[model samples]
Target: MFKDRTEAGRLLAERLKKYRNDPGIVLAVPRGGVPLAYFVAKELGYPIELILTKKIGHPTNKEYAIGAANLSDYFIIHPGAVSEDYIQQELFVIRTRLKEMYKKFMGNKTPENIAGKTVIIIDDGMATGNTMLGTLNLIRQGQPGKIIIGVPVSSKEAVEMLSKEVNEVVVLLSPEAFYGVGAFYEDFKQISDEEVIFYLSQLQKPS
Candidate 1:
């Protein structure tokens, strides 16, 4: 279908060009979102930063995220990911790891910077959307003026669910036969920490 994630990101950037001169920031979910959000940030002229969070995977299946956790003083946990018993047991470990991530990436900065500002949250795509939902909930407490969730492609269910959560939602494709986020792209390799560091370093924030 599409040549690769870069081309798809360019196309998605074109659609979001109107935000270039507007007051906004593109908060990207790291790893996969960096490439797509990098292009969008380059085109949109908004600074891009990682919305750091972790998937609270099932007790056994680590890859399968039953819920998600966003740590920055306060953490938003998803209920469906596990039961209360599991959460009570696992919260400390997740928090400790997240703090380590915060120190390594964000340098223990306060997460209140996005307050009262327009935030454009970008991701490569959305599937179950529980992760993003927790993201929204976590940031909403910071009192952003408006939240716009953007993605290049998503399933019908994800699009529908996300639309009701944010002020504006942009989705480029919602194929009925959606299998998974990786299926649409030719290169779905995991994005490395070095790449994330490189892009964030290169992005120039308007003063």
Candidate 2:
């Protein structure tokens, strides 16, 4: 288990050393992945961007992700799992949340373009990988030159599922007995909006 997200990020950065100073953008899953992406972007001297995708959950079981969507696009990962009305409602709610989060995280700065650029998607960890898959699908719309998955830890199934969809996968650990993402981290605290803003501010300062 990692001491914390910072340590996990540092170790993950070492594995991604080859990409240092390359033409790429790191798109981190917000809140949890921001801290980890900060380290990778800082290490590689690349800019860090946020991939704002929210899961469209099932009507009966909120925990069950039927699909995922961003501002411009939405995908129903599980066919006929959720109704059109549910998806529409969730999409509207998610868009509102995404706007608030984007404003809080980056203020007026527009998101970086991914076309013709190597895209590194970073997250603290993954369990089912559905959310990340949704993010990837959205990113695909941008037609990135390459897509890479970077995570500190993930389940075996998640790794396999992601490996086929992306150009490369860099995961620190993928244990067979994986219970949850937090189980692999010693100090997996809930990341706050202020913390996310702080990291973004630090990264944008003139070097």
Candidate 3:
């Protein structure tokens, strides 16, 4: 078990030391991933950017994710599982929120281009990997030279699911009897938008 997201990020950064100073950018899955990604970016001397994406939850059971969507693109793991109307509605709502988040955190700055550059995607943890699968599909459109996923802990299923898609999956723990992401952390707290802004601001400061 890790102490918190900060420690988890530091350890993940240690494993990713070979990529330090490489022509790569860190894409953090907010708002939980920001803190962890901040530490990793600091350790690797890379710029940090937010990869804004949210899961498209099933209509019947909102907790179950059928796919994921960003502002421009989306991925559906189970195409016929949900209705077209539902997907469209979810996409609109999710994109609207993502736009607000992007504006809030980045102000008027444009997103970084990842073409021909190594892209390291960081998150607190993965559960079913459905959401991440959706994220990967969108990231692929950017034509990155290589894609890597860094997480502190994940379920065995999540690791297996993501391993086949990305160039590499760096994980600290993949327990067979997997529990939710927060269960492994002693100080797991919901990250607020204010905290997200703070971390991003810190990343922008001169070293």
102-194 per-residue lDDT for model 3 (tens digits): 999999988889998889999999999888998899899999989999999999998988999999999999888887999999999999989
lDDT of 2 by residue, 13-83 (tens): 89987887568998889889999999999998889888888888888987777778888889888777667
Worst 10 residues of 3 by lDDT: 15-24
TM-scores vs. true structure, each candidate: 0.84, 0.97, 0.96
Using lDDT as the measure, the top candidate is: 3
Off by over 4 Å in 1: 58-67, 73-85, 107-112, 204-207
What does the lDDT come to for candidate 2? Answer: 0.88
Count clashing residue pairs in model 1. Answer: 2
- Candidate 3 regions exceeding 4 Å error are none
Error of 3 at 145 (Å): 0.8
Clash pairs (backbone) in predicted model 1 = 66-81, 67-81
Q: What is the Cα-based lDDT of residue 59 in candidate 1? A: 83
Displacement of residue 157 (Cα, Å) in model 1 is: 0.4
Candidates sorted by lDDT, descending order?
3, 2, 1
- Please report, in order, the local distance difference test score of every candidate based on alpha carbons: 0.76, 0.88, 0.91
- Arrange candidates, best TM-score first: 2, 3, 1
TM-score head-to-head 2 vs 3, winner: 2
